[model samples]
Target chain A: MFKPELVNTIVDAHQGPDGLLTILHAIQEEFGFISEDAMRQIALRLNITRAEVYGVVSFYHDYRTQPVGRHVLKLCRAEACQSMGGDTNAAALLARLGVDWGGTTADGRLTVEPVYCLGLCACAPSAMLDGALHARLDAAGLENLAQEAL
Target chain B: MRIYIPCDAAAIATGADKIAAAITAEATRRGVNAHIIRNGSRGMFWLEPLVEIVTPQGRTGFGPMTVADVPGLFEAPATHPKAVGLVEEIPFFAKQQRLTFARCGVIDPLDLDDYTAHGGFAGLAHAIKLGPAGICAEVKESGLRGRGGAGFPTGIKWETVRTAPADQKYIVCNADEGDSGTFADRMMMEGDPFSLVEGMTIAGIATGATKGYVYIRSEYPHAIQTLNTVIARARQAKLLGADIMGSGYSFDMEVFVGAGAYVCGEETALLDSLEGKRGQVRAKPPIPALVGLFGKPTVINNAISLFTIPVILEKGAKHYADFGMGRSRGTMPVQIAGNVKHGGLFEVAFGITLGEIINDIAGGTATGRPVRAVQAGGPLGAYFPPHMFDTPYDYEAFTKRDGLIGHGGLVVYDDKVDMAKMARFAMEFCAHESCGKCTPCRIGSTRGMEVMDKIIAGQEPEKNIALVKDLCETMKFGSLCALGGFTPYPVLSAMTHFPEDFSKAAIKLAAE
Candidate 1:
């Protein structure tokens, strides 16, 4: 939904070998997700094909092609959290939300995604709500947070 | 009066920012004039958002604080409910030697004056005087090795890069710390960014590299922001860019944000990512020293390895080298994580036993259950049972047990852990993260997961176990990089140390 001028402004700001990543990041920051039209414009600006842009976008976990919910919940599933009952907590959270990994709730209030680690392993079973991390998360704590997010 | 609270990602994750604001507001309301310095974590993560009041006695600690408790903190700073006595006296913080992290929680990360006042940049100043070879020789004398898993002598690597003839050599800092249970790099970068900036500048001076790139994972947004700000500030102060500090040598650095790819933590893969491509592992023969980062000779070191350089130079190589045991000569920032009660960052000399780390320092599992196993290193590291806790944290000692001191991340597990499931998770993680460039890592991981599932399902359990062993051997010997190669360490070690857990999984399936 971005205007052509705004798209061009973002694309024009980057130069050199890192232009693609820079352009994509700027676009994602300005807009919620990368659109197909944006990809085409990026391809044209960077002198690469849309397929290459798509490949890069899909490969990385952080880039989203579609719009997301109001709140993004990233639950850590790495070894450190796993050692602290993250699996059980992850399962409970997913079941309560009625969504799988990377799925958004029906009301568009929350989206639960699986992240490898958030470096809060010392306070294990951590989760990040819209980029703010919460550690030592129990079932109750998570449920309360989820309700608050809703 | 002065007060300190962490603005580190780990601290911020636990609401450190909110706590700082509350403290500021509370102090104003109470008509108390106080200076609030947002420092980094002391590594006592359990006491996160750990606030300290600089009392005459010392930096008195009050922790795990929230907004609600801020008002009370102003009323009675020392006698607050969250007060845990002096920070240095707390058993968790008292029992460790912190070298690279010495200024972590003590100084304002963004303040150059604070950093200089705290014995920072002395290394760079010394390196400028010593010249390239002198700096390299001192590092050699210090016996410092790469803190990022490989344990290769850092001085030797620098010497190689220094000798390599390239008009456009580069220094690539591998900040893509993808390993689970490892946050030392992130913490260091977020807490003390100028240290890294100084270290890389020193590398540029020693190796004659005029340009550098710090490739950090996108997951660490806070670290990226911190580093960007520091790099700009350093540039403004002439600590970086053309003719740094009025010296003839010119070096500049840029921060490259990486998309999530565990394999990119590998040096060559990081270079590929830097070049705006998929992070597939490259074969080594020419080595990164001869050819790296768009085929130019490059000096690629992990964040910790580079960060340690400034200290090595400032303190004199011998002084830093005198701290650790054997060839692993220096302190290690061991992250005590997972189920541990007082899990935090404990930087100690080499040769500290795992038993002491888990029992004495960490205070055992937070769940109050008996420690079942401890996974030292990261996902690729081996799992050690309770009996093996006597093994020291030295590089060679860990290698002797088929374990790696990879990033010095230690994750503890309690009695409820299932070895079979943990083994499966290793393969699952590898399969997901594999770049699909090598056969063993790409296909073998999926096959290993299938075999593990069969064993758990009790379908020819004995045969499945044998198949897993055979598969792991192939993946170990046949894989191109550590991602595929070291995945077996966790899988095989779990099955070897905790065979009973595997048997129980199969037995339960059989009973069903």
Candidate 2:
């Protein structure tokens, strides 16, 4: 989706071995996601094969092969969160949205995911809605928050 | 200068991003230049929203910051009015050894210069100078044990792999860390990716392995992303390829994401996952050291165990061996979560008591309720009451008290929790998550859940109670690995420790 010049600019900034991932991330960020063209280009530029580049992308869970929604919702599934009825809350939310964790909704309004912990154990149940934290939530709390936020 | 803000899930949950926004807005309102770089968390949760101002004195720390405190920070850039002193001086970070987390929060995570300035790969440089035997001897002398569940001696394990005859060897890091209330690995990897990379490289050097893989769980996306970035960076720098640091030892690493399978945290299963097969744990007569990863010798290690190696080299093995009690040696990074007020990462030597940690350092629960049980380790770990609070938190010390030191995750729960429900939950969790590779874990867990249900239901009264206890005994002895074996810890501990709760819940349900 990037103009050829923007991609070139990002590729130029991608320097050094230590910042290789950051450079690739920058390329992806500029184009909304890493395109096959960019991956092939990176492989050619770095003197690595396309298969090797694809291997790195496939190995990591965070790398998105497909473009995602604008807003992200990550619910905590750590013990603290689970102890505070996170299981039930998550089930209800998933049921309501008809989208599982790591799946984008049909409308592309949200992308839901499960994170290990948010370290807000004092608050028990917690979730990040579009990079904002809402803590001490129950099934009702989650429902209301997700509904109102959207 | 651009100010970096932590966007790690933990920091964001504690409102770190908002604090960054507040600082930027306040700086704008006051006509000051402020750029925000959203990075990973600093590993300390209590000091979350932990903002750093890069000054003449280095990155000055201000923590547990909310948006409300932004006004005060903008007024004084060097010495913030609301900053909680310097992060270095703070006891949470200062008191203990931070070998694995050395460069975390102290340097720009993506910036190699900052990493080098903070003494990042000096250990690798030293390892290269000393060579494999020296590195092996150094680790063996350090008395470093696996920080994961087993607490096996790391040096011996590496030596075994080093001596083993195989055309291809592998260094597999078990990052599928599914332990509850433990985020130390995630935090460490996110904040300081280089330390893990350095540790893995050291393992490769010691064992003569050319390739490495970190099998991280799918649940931790941010950590995966961070590690991927760092690995690419290392490979690009020629530090991960054909000749690492010109030492003529080839090493490369790649991440293999696990699909939310708790049992995959076990080493063999992790290897299987790396091979692009279903994650099924293999039995250990040969051990992974002998026959592993396409029948090649493999050096499998937990993230913490791997990360601790650089320190063993940087400081002498004797220095590392000088800390802790009994067989458990060196400093441990204790992660206290759930209900605790001052919940954060506390790195302490082995001998610290559970009581001091929960009451003093944690400041008890945020709800101000009386803490009933403390689940040490993970879901499979023992639930200790106040009486056991005096017990020491270490590997061998915990075993003496019939408890586990699993990944050092201490989950605190209040008085309102029902032990019967907790016991049932444990059985249910085992039944749900068990990989079904072995018969005991597969069938025994399901049986355990059903019996626990009968006990709660008061079906046949005394008979059901006896049956549940007997089932727990069967699971403990008959299971192939720790999956089904350790599930009984929670069930039995809850029943033995809090019999009153179970009796009341059962009786109440019967009456109803």
Q: True contacts preserved, each candidate?
A: 0.71, 0.26
Q: How well does candidate 2 match the true structure in TM-score terms? A: 0.83
- Tens-digit lDDT track of model 2 for B361-403: 8888756898889999888999999889999977877888888
Give the alpha carbon lDDT tens digit for every residue of B435-504 in model 1.
Answer: 8889999999999999999887777888889999999999999999999999999999998988887777
DockQ of each: 0.74, 0.17
lDDT of 2 at B436: 71
Listed in order, each prediction's TM-score against the native is: 0.98, 0.83
Clashing pairs in 2: A17-B233, A17-B236, A17-B237
Instruction: Place model 1 in a CAPRI quality band.
Output: medium
Q: For residues A38-98, what per-residue lDDT tens digits would candidate 1 score against the true structure? A: 8888888788998999987876777889888899988989999998888898998898779
Off by over 4 Å in 2: A1-78, A83-123, A128-144, A148-150, B1-4, B35-42, B54-63, B76-83, B509-512
TM-score of chain A of each: 0.94, 0.84
Point to the candidate with the largest lDDT: 1
Record all residue pairs in model 1 with backbone atoms less than 3 Å apart, i.e. clashing.
none
